[model samples]
Target chain A: MAAVPELLLDPAIKIWVLLPISIVMVLVGILRNNVTTLFLSPKRTVPNVRLLKEQQHLGLLRTYRRNHHVFISQSDFDEKFDLFKKEYEFDNLMRHYVADPEKLQKLKENPNDFNTVMSDLSSGDMMMQMLKGNLANYIPQTVIMYWVNFFYKNYIVMKLPFNLTNNFKSMLQSSMNMIDLDASYVSAISWYFVNLMGLSSIYALVLNDNEMVTQITQQTTQQQQPAPPTAGGPTVDQLFNSELEGFKITDIKSCFTTIHDRVLEKYQ
Target chain B: MPIVNPSPRQPIVIIMSSNKKYLLNQYKTSQYLNLSPPNLLQLFNSCKVFLATTNKLSPLERQSILELYFYLSILTNHDIEAKSTLQKLKESLPLTSKSEKLAVLESYYLEAIGSTNTSSSTSQEKKDAKQVSSSKKQETILKELEEYLTQVQTLIVNDENKSRAMSLTSQQAGPLSRMTTNDLRTIVKRKVALHKSFSSIDTYVNQLIDFLQVNTMDPFTWNELGQTYHKLGELTKAHSCFMEIAVLQPLNYKNWLQLADLEVELFYSGDLVAFNVLNDSILHYLRAVELCEVLVDAWIGLVVALKLIPVSEMEKSGVNSKLKPLEDLKGKYDQLLKLAAKKVNKFVELGLVTDDKKLNSVKAVLDDTK
Candidate 1:
């Protein structure tokens, strides 16, 4: 009878103490998992400078493909290409380039051509800047960062021990929560990656088409020459007033009569 | 006769030729020519008298002159008298010499008469009068033939043979009554094709069917009638005709195909419900498929109809519970694919790569499902 009160009190104290402790442990485990996801995730940091370099290389190749004849006049094209390359490099370093003396010289020499070239260069530069400004804007960056943080924080940091029985049960419950979290993240990341790839491919296609049109225009201008007036009053008037005109009239009438005669002879 | 005017009648003189030149010149100068219809008729009669006396004219020249006379009669609304005079001129000319010209003139005459009849429906009396006048001309031709026969009788070396020939000629000359319904139907079809006028076609088709009765059971004729009925939106009649074809030629794929097409068309036009009408087509196609399972078109139709009924609704209808039938169908499709593969294997064994790409694609889909 005396031992019954002790037993009751002992169980009550354990419930009061362990319940709060267990709640704290579970909450801390969740917080640790989230923190790891945030900080220690393997993130892809896009090198803006590297992207700019690659874009510049592609732009040069496109320009060459478009105006292959321009490459035949190597000195002129190379000088222009060098100027464009310098402008791009400056833009990369400065985040944006103001109209510099070299750029002004290029513009003055071929104002229309230079304007289009500069516009394309600036657009590519701006895109790179935006990518660098937010890692999440690029899918691979976000995915890598998410997984790295998740692995580091939850598995590595949250190594706390509890009584084996309780700890096993808590781990099981947390793992269920983890499955849902992992599914959602995977779905989002996959969607983002697919969309980003599609958009980038479309951008590439447009750029390719632009380069093709520019090259065609340049080649046509090179091949074409103005015609000089002939010795006659004009070729048009000569053609209209020549003996051929009289011959044509007779020819037309003859043609009609021949057809008429053939049809009549056949039917008759 | 006095000359009335010169310039207005110049065209008529040129058309009639130089032999009638004096008569036309007199008519142009005539004082009574423009006075009234009777006075105009008198002047024209004087011209005709002069034309009849002109003997030096060639046969072509005579035709040209007589054509002018008929033209004047038509312009003056004296069509009955014009037609009689033209018929007389036609008979007097050697048949071969004027046949082509006469055919042209007859077509013009018929067109003119048709236009005149259409223009004024006010006077039934005028129409009746024209009919009576035509009948009189026919009677006059018959009387001339009788006189000619009597004249021939006087010269006959064999009287019985002459009488027999006269009887045969008379029988040929009498009205042949009506054409066979088949001929009428052919004429109707030609007219429908040429004029594309349903107004005449409907009447002609009905006349042919009524006249021909059971003789009109020819599938081609029924098919044509069904098409015409369908065009007119007389679905019941069209259906009956099509059904008759189906009954008459149960094995004819074309008849079944047309019926299926009509059912779909009727369903689309709101003449039939989507469900009921489409099911009828589906059933027909199923029958067609049963007859020829290699019928890709029928299979396509079945696939389309089945696709239209939502899978969720099918499930709700206990279709899923009873999917043994569907499973059996799926198994059949699979078996068919296997058979197709075997057939392709035979072709492949002979080194035919033309169908290899398609077979490979089908094989891919099969493999993916498996």
Candidate 2:
């Protein structure tokens, strides 16, 4: 077992360094949120008619599959299922989209040009979206790091009033000129990170419940397809087919047991 | 120890702090509370003062303000300033705002306008032989609401149109991406609730049932869907809806009372599929009272259900175990009646229950002095 060292930090460090970094992070987050909202203007506000149609159909299918038994007779459910299967089975919109000669020609001529392909079925401006998300998350962090490194280098921001481990000492003393920096001490470079992580709740109150840290931390988890290389975006037909398969596998009867038994149970 | 001189609303501050626990109770008994108009006015003023003092009221708080104003105006008929409030809601609300209560209130205000206009037309028809044609005004308002609801339906219920609607709503002030499904479902429920015709309600039910298929956890929607059936005169489906609600929220006395009421309705209609429905109604009413003793509505429902239950069925259903509750109810019947009379007098003093039929109904039930 390794023994942990301790050092006490000055209360003055909280007011001077910690507060400034956190305030900066919170401000940066709000700025990024507003900027992101502004940048997506024309596309965000204008309805893409094709995408809307597909989504509405998907909603209809999902709603019907899950709850039709409650409202409709068994005969009606079966009839609707038959109609849905017939309409959506062979002429899958997504599959049809993949084979269009005009779309294929555009993709072939300029393989790297996402904007042209993304206009209709190819990913809904995914590259632009990814760029915006990454910029929002990483730009402030990298800029802040460089700014802090260049300005506050070789300066110890504060000393931790408690002792800590050698590993932590190395991390806290990254920019400090001292050879054996105290574990309890925080360099100005490292101080920025501690404050950045703690200012989420403060900004959430100010920015209409928008969290600054989430913009940075959860960027990698954004919707990106690692599926077939060419098909970059999720299409309505693909989702519909998958949802239909899910509906087929699970018996609705199992989810919905007769309510008569439920009602009778209380009586007994 | 005195940090600052307390405001005159000191008693209200204490009540506000104490009443947090009783909010659910208050929601259930808002009808009975509506009788005492002065108490309501006090509550409204206190809420208004608190809201004024608070920095940036949250959406939940705003929703409460809407509800309080709704009870004050709609229930108490003190809607003298309602038009200004309705205008305020319109001006402030983001065009694509997704609050369900907001959706309901929008329709309610419109409906109130329609009915009020109709009543005004007839009253003025006698005075004006040669002017003031306002009969078309009600039709126009109703038509506008119907058109708005259809647009919402296309935007939400139709999956193909949802993305388009999303893009359109993005331009609006407060329509967050998270509120898509919830907002749509709420719009559907509110629209159905406001539908004057049963056929319109039936059509809306198909969509509501489909939405509920996937999101069955929402109990309020389930109750709303059941009430739609109750309106459409489908007692079996109504019972099913309440039954589903009871299963989802076992401790909720409201669902049981609704179910008991449905059974009583069925007993009256002579549409008993099972001979045990009469006993079942009594059982459900008992269960409701047991779940919430403070539910004064449930007591009335119990009295109705019990009065209908045949004497022979009680014996067959093991009357011994249920005897104690019946005895307790009978013992307190006279006292409960007195409390009810006092409440009725308070309501009368407020001039709310002015209609003869309404007064006669209450007098028939609680007027045990004779």
The best candidate in terms of TM-score: 2
Model 2 lDDT tens row, A150-177? 7667556777667787779667877565
Q: What does the lDDT read for residue B27 in candidate 1?
A: 35
Error of 2 at B23 (Å): 9.5
CA lDDT for candidate 1: 0.41
**Tens-digit per-residue lDDT, B14-133, candidate 1:** 232334564444334433333344545655665577577778776755665566566556555667867886797779765533232344345345444543233354587556656766
CA lDDT of A38 in candidate 1? Answer: 40
Backbone clashes in candidate 1 total 17
- Tens digits of per-residue lDDT, candidate 2, B168-233, equal 113222112223433454555555444433235665688668656545556767887898889889
RMSD of each: 44.6, 14.7
Interface RMSD of 2: 13.0
Name the TM-score of candidate 2. 0.45
lDDT by residue (tens digit), candidate 1, A1-268: 2321211123443344334333333333234333323432122121232233333334433433343331112343345445435533423422322257676555445534433443454444334333332332224335443643343223211112332333343332332334322221222223222332333233334444554334323222233211111211322212223322232222111111122223223322
Complex DockQ, candidate 1:
0.00
State what share of the real interface contacts each candidate retains: 0.00, 0.00
Worst 10 residues of 1 chain B by lDDT: B168-177
